[model samples]
Target: MKEYKRFLLYGLVVGTVIGFYLIFNLKSFVSYENIFIDKTDFMLSSRLIIYNKTCGLQHWKEKKNFGHRDDIPFFSILSTILSSTEKKIIIIEFGANVGQFSERVLSIPHKIPYIVHSIEPVLTLFHLLRNRSRTFKKEKNDKHFHYNLAISDQSGEKPIYSPSQYGEGSTLGKAFLSNFKEIENVTVTTLPEFIKKYHIKTPISFIKIDVEGFEPEVIRGMNLSINAKIFPLFSFETGETWLDDRSVLAKEYTLKSFVEMLNYFQYDSYFIGNPYLLPISGTYWKNSFDGLRRNPNVLAILRHSQPWKNLKKLLNRIPFTSC
Candidate 1:
């Protein structure tokens, strides 16, 4: 009888301890204050705000040759065209660093059979792109191709600077300081050569050119006549700074020159940003150019004709201004 009473006492103590533990821990789980402080206050308030704003919706978190922003207007316009049209789209991306833009392009909703051809001169970056292309191809089935070559005015490989020490696929021309070595000299070819090689007689939908400071050379190599055949859209990167040097060009390439060059092909050009038009006195250009040269960040979109009218309308719906 005494032993039974002792067992009952022991059971009561264990039950009380278990009850207290449950009350303390489980209370925190169900408490409104806990939810407010832990999940709502921290996760939603702190982390989500910056991550969603900068990376998730803004799409600027990734390390791209061009700093991140929302999707490029030209790409958005091209996606709209591809979504609407029955024609196959071919995108040739020059200086494709880690296939960031190519990945974004494939993500757009479209039924048009699209082929993305990416060219990267740097060996390490080419390997990264090759791997990414394989993964993308495995998922999508024959949608992308990667090549290791430097696109120049003529065919024949030249000295390529592979700065593996930088640890990023995309490096500004001035940022490359790694050891120089002889990489397989894949002869540079023009856009026409690419089209012929691929048997892509269809209308070329888009061409994204970003070869650091070598933009002019790539432009000169391409046959603009082919542009007439396909009405291809171009998005090239240019800056006032020469390769690997912060020293500004003596005579920098101006928007006016770019406009004149494209105008020769009857392509109307417009600068994409808050101020739709270039400033009258070129003060804006001088300041912005200097700012970007020092910081090495800034992206401007050039489109054929006023293709961004729809985009401008869309931007008006947003509460904030663009960079």
Candidate 2:
């Protein structure tokens, strides 16, 4: 009996050590905050496991807090757009899932007049976003416009492939079809068309694109020639394995083409986040795309962009890594 008790005590000690080791290693996976929580993901997972017994549906939950931890630093970079512009700023956000980032933008303490055009195509997510934006406290002159449409190269109904577990995975890219199990038809709009339709005259300050692998389509929708005077800062998601040939959009569309398009439109590329924005050389961009150090997001700057000038001075004062 004593020997059995001794074995049990040793097993307990080993289990405790293993648990702590796992927790320490897992901490590296979560960026920014020590805690990771996605209300929608948790709700959907619970629903699937406890009630539905299926994980084929993605539903929306009210965005009560900043859903992503990374947004804290990302928004700080985003605020530079407003600081650079003397005129009232307008922010256009594509793929605004549940308005978490928009909420962060709205919460920033600033007296500058600003408006947010939050676009989310998914019906369920759009509903949650609309609700959240309505209740958010806005500064005097701060306004928000919610659009239930997808920003793409064309304006029409498009089949957005969505995974049951993560609605944010929904995309207009045909290449992403394999990752998603369900098809959702969403109304699509071009940026130029949206501006015209709404008669938005505010000086566009920034645009954030998170349309999964279909980012090239969003870039195509804009009329850069006329908007060059506004010269808004552009930040967007560059998906993992951007060079993967299996991606439906990637088969025909390459990351190089996307970068070249921005270059043709008079925009320079930079790697942003990590509190400092680093200018990405053509070789570095290519190497990054080829999988040296995968960056989830990149920023585009115009030659005359006032923000880039101030951003350099501001970033230099802080200590940060090139993430």
lDDT of each: 0.50, 0.63
Give one digit per residue, the lDDT tens place, for model 1 in 1-323. 99999999999999999999878854533442211122466534221111012221222223222332223533644455331123556777888888888887876666567777888877777889888765553234336878877776667655554335433423223333445333434556776676688676545566777675666566667756455535345655544434454213313455445445665665544233222222112222233333233212222222322323333333222333232
Tens-digit lDDT track of model 2 for 1-323: 99999999999999999989868754422432312233476534211101110110111011221122343466765586553345677788898999888888888788787788899988888889999888887898898999888887778887766765446667665553466655578888888888889987745688888876667667766767777656457777765534443244444655566667677777777545344344453543444343312435667777556765555334323332222
Top candidate on lDDT is 2
Clashes of 1: 2
The positional error of residue 22 in candidate 1, measured at the CA in angstroms, is: 67
Per-prediction TM-score to the true structure, in the order listed: 0.57, 0.68
Global Cα lDDT for candidate 1: 0.50
Task: Identify the candidate with maximal TM-score.
Answer: 2
Candidate 2, which segments miss by more than 4 Å at Cα?
Answer: 1-72, 83-86, 174-176, 241-249, 252-257, 283-286, 292-295, 319-323
Among all windows of ten consecutive residues in candidate 1, which has the lowest summed lDDT?
A: 47-56
